[model samples]
Target chain A: MSVLALSVILAFVTPQAGSTPAPTAQSRQAGDAREMTLTLPHALRKGETAWLLVTVGMIGHNQIQLTTQSGKDLGNISPFGIRSGQAAGTYTIPVPAEALSGRRLVLRLSVPQAGGLHRATTTEEVTSVRLVIQRFGNGN
Target chain B: MSIYFETTRRDFLKTSLATAGTAALSRHLALAQAPAKYRRYSVTSQQGQKALVSYAKAIQAMLNLPADHPQNWFRNAFVHLMDCPHGNWWFYVWHRGYLGYFEQTIRTMSGDPNFAMPYWDWSDLAQIPDSMFNDVLTPVASAYERYTKDLQTFTAFIQPSLKNYWGKLSPAQIQQLNIRGYKTFDDMWNDVSGWTPTPMTGHLSHPGHFNPENTAFAPTPIARYLTLQNPQLSDSVKKNVSKGTVYSGLEPTNFATTYYQHIPIANPIKIGFNSSTTASHNTAPSKGTVFSTLEGLPHNSTHNYIGGGAGEGSPIPNGPWGNMTNNLSPVDPIFFLHHSNMDRLWDVWTRKQQALNLPYLPNSQQLPSYEKEPFLFYVDGNGKQVGPSIAKEYISMSRFGYDYEPGYGEEIIGKRNLVLAAKHPTASVEGLMKGNAATLTLSAAAIKTHLDSDTATSLFALVTVPRPTENSPNREFDVLVGAPADATNITADSPYYAGKVAFFCGMMHMSGMTDEATFIVPLPKRKEAFANLSAAAGNVAVTIRAVPSGGGASVLRAVTVQSL
Candidate 1:
C-alpha cells in the first residue's frame, strides 16, 4: 500500500460527484438568499444630488419598505424603536437626479416578524448608474 | 504567475518598508513594549525609508490640490482610478484614498502623535528571496516590471477596444485579467487609457493625449514601469475599469451585516481564531500551487481570498489581502485590524459589569440531548438573532470603546463541549415519591449557576405520580443543586436548600418504565460567566440521564415543591 499510501486512499475515496456544494448552514438557511448589484455612485449626478445608505438591520417585527419599478415609494426604513438588540443602522436617503435612471432596478426590503409571525423579503438589484450628462459650457 | 507576483510584489515592498520601520522604532520603544494601547511616532528609523517618505509626501499632497478641490477631483480621480478593476467601490474608494495618503504621510513623519499603522508581512513571502522581486525599491518589484511592459501597451490600446466591446474574451476572461482581474500595473493602465484623470502633482498638469502611432513602440520593462510612475496614465485610450476578485473580500457569512467584520482597532483584546473550521496542512502541488489544510481553503478562515488563483490546489498570498477596494489587506491593514479584534471578543464574552452574558444550554444537534452548548449567530432571512453567545451579547466593552492593550498575540479562547457529571456522594438526592417525600427545587443551591446564556434556561426536580412506568426499562435520574459558601448568594433564602441537594446526573438512555422520573440535565461547566466572588463555591455534582421510564418524566412539571 504505497505510492504515497495509495494516494492517501484515493484521496479519501474520491467524490467530486455532481459538485457545487460548499455553502451550507443548511444551504444558506432558508427561503434561500444570495443576490447582489449596487451600481449607484458616480458622485450620483443628473438631477445632481446624492445620499442613500439605508441599512435596516435584520428588521424582524415588520416594517422596511423601498421601491421603484415605477411603484416609486423608494422610502421608509424605520427599523422600529431602535435597539431590539441592534445591528442595523445608517440611513441617509435623498438621491434625486431623476431618481437615477434605469437599466434594471428593484430595491424592495419588507420584513414582518413575530407580532405578525411571518413575512420576510429582501430584494436588491440596483444597476442604474449611467451619468455623463455634463453639457453646460462643453468643457470636453 | 511570476511566482505569485514575486511573492506579492516583494512582500508589498517589504511590508510597506517594515511597517515604515516599525512606525519608527515604536517611538524609542515605549507604550511599554508595543502590543496595544499604542500611538507613538517620530519616523527616521529608515526601513522602507518612511515608505519612500510616505510616498513622496502623499504624492506631494495630492499634487498640490486646487483643480476644483473636491479633494482635487478626489485626488485626481483617485490617482487616475489606479487603473481600474480590483473589485470595485472604485476599488474601495481608491484604497481609502491611498491609505488616506499613507496615513497622512505617517502623521507628517511622526510629528502627529497618534501613530499605529504597521502591517505588511504577507506570510513572510513563504520565506523571501527572488531578489525580492528584483528590488527596484519595491512598488511590487516596480509594479512587476511595470506589468510586463504594459503588455505591449495593452496590445496596442486595449486590444482594439476590448475586441469592440467584450467580444473576444475567454482564455478565462484573459486569465481573469491576469490572475483574478486587475492584476495591477496601475490596473492595466486603467484599461489602456480613458479612465483619464491627467494631472502630475496636483493642480491639473496634463500629459494626456495618446496614439503617437501607438506610442512609437519599444518601451517595455513594463513601459519603464508605466513611464516611471504614471506619466499621466497614457498608452492610448479605451476605458472600462473595476478589477476586484480573489472572490472580492469581506463575506464571512456577511458577518453581522458587515459593519466592521472582525474588529482590530489596535488589538482591543484580540483573538481571531475562526480557524475556518478545523485546521490542517500539506497539499502543496508546487507552482500551480494548492497546499490545503488551513481548513481546505475558501478565503482560508475568518475571510479574504478574493478573485481567485492559487490554482494547482491553491494557497499563495491567500491571506492579508485587500485590493479590488475592500481596502486593508495589503499584507495586513491588520486585516481590518484582526477582525476588529474578533469583534471585541464577542463584545467581551457577551458583556459584563451590569450583567447578562447569558446561555447555559440549547445549541441543539438534538441527539440523546447531551447539553453544554451556547454560541448562536444568524443575520437575515428573517430569523434575526445576530448575536446571543460569546456569553450574552454586549452591554459594554467600555461601550464600543477602544484603547486596545494586551501583548498582541490576538488572544482567542472560547469553545468547549465535552459533557458528563454525577454527584450524589452526599450533596443530596433521596427518593420515594407519591408514598410521600417531596424535595425538588432550584434557583441555585450548589453548582453556583454559571453556564452562561444566549438561550436555554432550566433548573428542575419535582415528584408525584400515583401510578406510571410500564415496569421500568430505564430511569436513572439525578441532577440536584446547592452547596454554596465561598461568598454565597442563592437569595430566595439559602441554607443549602435545608436538606437534599443531589446536584448532577444523567444516565437515561431511553426506556419505558412508570411511577415518575424527570432529568433533562447536562451542565458540566465552561460556557462561562465567572465574576469571581472568591470563585463562587460550586462544590457538589451530578448529571445522569436514562429516562423513558414511567410516563417519560413529563419535564417533571417544572419543579418547585420545597420542604424537607
Candidate 2:
C-alpha cells in the first residue's frame, strides 16, 4: 500500500467533529511506499508530554522531523522499534522548550529502506502533520 | 444674605491669596505648554508629500557628512533607539519619543522649523502614497545616480567585512557550516538559505546605509527570493513592484471594513496601557471575553502582513518592509510614517473613550513605571548626547512642538457607524478536529441592512480566546463566512473565507501577565453568498474551521460574527 492510499483511509476513519480525540487511523499511498497516519490531540498544553502511536505498515527504519511553516527545522524523532504490518509501541515525542512559541509545528515522517539493493539509499515519503501547543490551564 | 456675603478683612486677604495662587498656577501651566509649531499632514496630500520630500533631502545631505558629525548622528540614532520596547507596554511611548526627536533633528537640519513628519494612514488609504512610490517629490535622476554609486561603495565594504566576520563564527557554527560543505564565506553567503542573520547593532557609517534608495526594503525572505529570481528588472522597478506587492498583500480594503471596523474604541487604549485589573494586562479576561480587540487584530495583522506572511492577504509571505519585524523595522523609512498613523489611532481611541466617560491611562501615566523606566539614549537640542530619558517626558507630542493634522481622529471616528452592525451571541469551542468546523448563525436581515447601507460593507469574524502562556506555540484557525454548505475549502481570496485567527504568543505575551487574545478577520465580500442567504435562510451562518497546520486543543472560547 502507498502513502497516498493510507492517508485517505486515515481521514475516513478519524472522527469528523468535536475537540476530543478517539483512537483513529489513516493511510495513504505514494509510489511503492505505504504510510499510516496517527492522530494527535487537537491542542497541546505547554510543557505537556505528547505520545504518538505508530502503526507499522512496512519493515523499515522511520524518523520524524518537526518544522515550522517557514521551514525552520525544529527537531527530529528517530529509532523506531516497530515490526512491519503491526501495531507499534507508543513513542514519546518531547515538545521542545522553544517549540512553545505560539507557532504551528509541522511533523514530517521518513522511512529509510534497509537491506535491499536500495538499502540506505532512499527514504519512504510520509505526509506532514501539524501540531499546535496552546497555553497550559487556559480554559477555552 | 448681605451679612453672609460680607467677609472679615483677614478672611478676605486669605481668599484673595488663594484666588491669586489659582490664577498663577493656571498661567504656569499655559506657559509650560509648548506651541504646536509643526502640523503632521496626510501622506496622500500634496503639502504632506512636499514636506516629506524636503525632509528626505535634508536627511540625505546630513548622510553625506562624516560619521562623527552631529547632523549624521540623527540618522544613525534611529537604528539604535528602535531596538527596545517592541511587542511590550513600551511599544507606543518609545516610538513616540523616537519620532519626536527625529522630527526635531529634521527641522534643525533642513532649516525649516515648521516641518513635521507626514503619516501614511494605511487603515484609511490602504495604498502606499504615490509620493513614496514615485519620484514626485524627490526626482529620481540625480538621487538614483548617487544611490547607485553609494550602493557599490557600501557593497564593497560589507562583502569583505562579512568574510572577516565569517571567520570569527563560533567553532560550533563553523563546524556546522563546514559539514554543510561551505568552504568560504562567499560560498555560505551565496547559498540559497532560509537562515536569518543575527541582527546587527551600533551605528552604520555608510551613505548608502542612510539612503532609502540604496537599499531595497523587502522585509520577508520570499520577497528577497522573488527579487533574486527577477534580476532582469531595473532596481527601481524591482523596488516599486516590491512595494506594490506589500501594499496588495496587506488587503487594505478588507482590513479597513472588517478588522478595523470591529475594533472597539477602548481596545487601542487598553492593550498597551490597561490597568492591572483590565482585561489585557496582568489578569486574563474570563473565557470568551472580547478584549484587546485592536492590539490582537488590526495592529498585529498589519505588522505580520507587512513584515512577512502570517496574517491576512496572500497566504504567502511577501518581501521585507522594516516595519514587518519589531526590532529592525525602524530602519526602513516607512516605519516612521506607519507608526505616526498608529499614534494617531491611539489618540483617536482616547478621544472616543473620553467622550464616553470611559477610564483610560493618560499619556503621562501610560506605563506604571514610566517615570523611572529608561528608554533610549540620543543627542539632545544642545548637541550633547543625553542619557536615557524616562517615558513620562515623551508622552505628550505637543511637548515636542508637533501635533497630528487637526481633526484626524474625527475622520476615523465618523467611519464607526458602518462598523456598528448587530453582533451575534458568542459561540464557544473547546476543540475541533481537522476539517471539523464551528458555526455561528446571525440574522440575515441585519447583515443585508448593513451591506445595503454602506458601499464598504464586509463581514467580520471576531474570535476571542484566553491569552496563551508566554512560550506557548502559535495557533491558527481559518474562518469561513457564508451559508454553511458553501463554506467548505474556502481560499483566502474567496469572499466567503475570512482571514486566519492567529495567536503569536512569544513577545506579545509577557510571562505571568494573563491577557485575553482576540482575532478579527474581515470576510471577503461575496455578494452571491449574501444573496443566496437572503433568498432562502432566515439566518446567515459563519463557520470557523481548524486548519491542519496547527494541531493542538482549541484555544477558541467565543466567536462573534459582526458586519461592517
Candidate 2 displacement at residue B135 in angstroms: 5.2
Report the lDDT tens digits of candidate 1 across residue range B1-564. Answer: 000001122343354455434433433343454344432121222332343344333333433444333232122232222222221111122222233334434344334434433322221111111222233322233332322245464355333433342343334334434533344443434433324334445545576433211111222231212112221211000000000100011101111111111232211110011111010111111111111111111112212212111111112212111121121122211222223333332322222100111221112332112121122221211212233322222222321122333211111111110001111112234333221223322224433433332111222233222222345333322222333213233221222221111112223333553334332222323222112323435422222221222223322222332111
Each candidate's fnat, in order? 0.00, 0.00
lDDT score, residue B122, model 1?
21
Q: For model 2, how does the per-residue alpha-carbon lDDT over B260-297 read when each residue is reduced to its tens digit?
A: 11122211111112111221211111211211223323
Prediction RMSDs, each to the true structure: 25.2, 20.7
Q: How many pairs collide in each candidate, listed in order?
A: 86, 39
Candidate 2, B547: how far from true, in Å?
33
lDDT, model 2, position B539: 70
Q: Rate the local accuracy (lDDT) of all candidates.
A: 0.25, 0.38
Question: Taking the tens digit of each residue's C-alpha lDDT, what string does model 1 give over A1-140?
Answer: 00100000001011123432211111111232221223332222111122233333333222333344343443433221121223333332322222333212233333323222213344221111111111111000
TM for every model, in the order presented, reads 0.26, 0.40
C-alpha positional error of residue B148 in candidate 2 after TM-score superposition, expressed in Å: 8.9
- Which whole-number lDDT from 0 to 100 does residue B235 have in model 1? 8
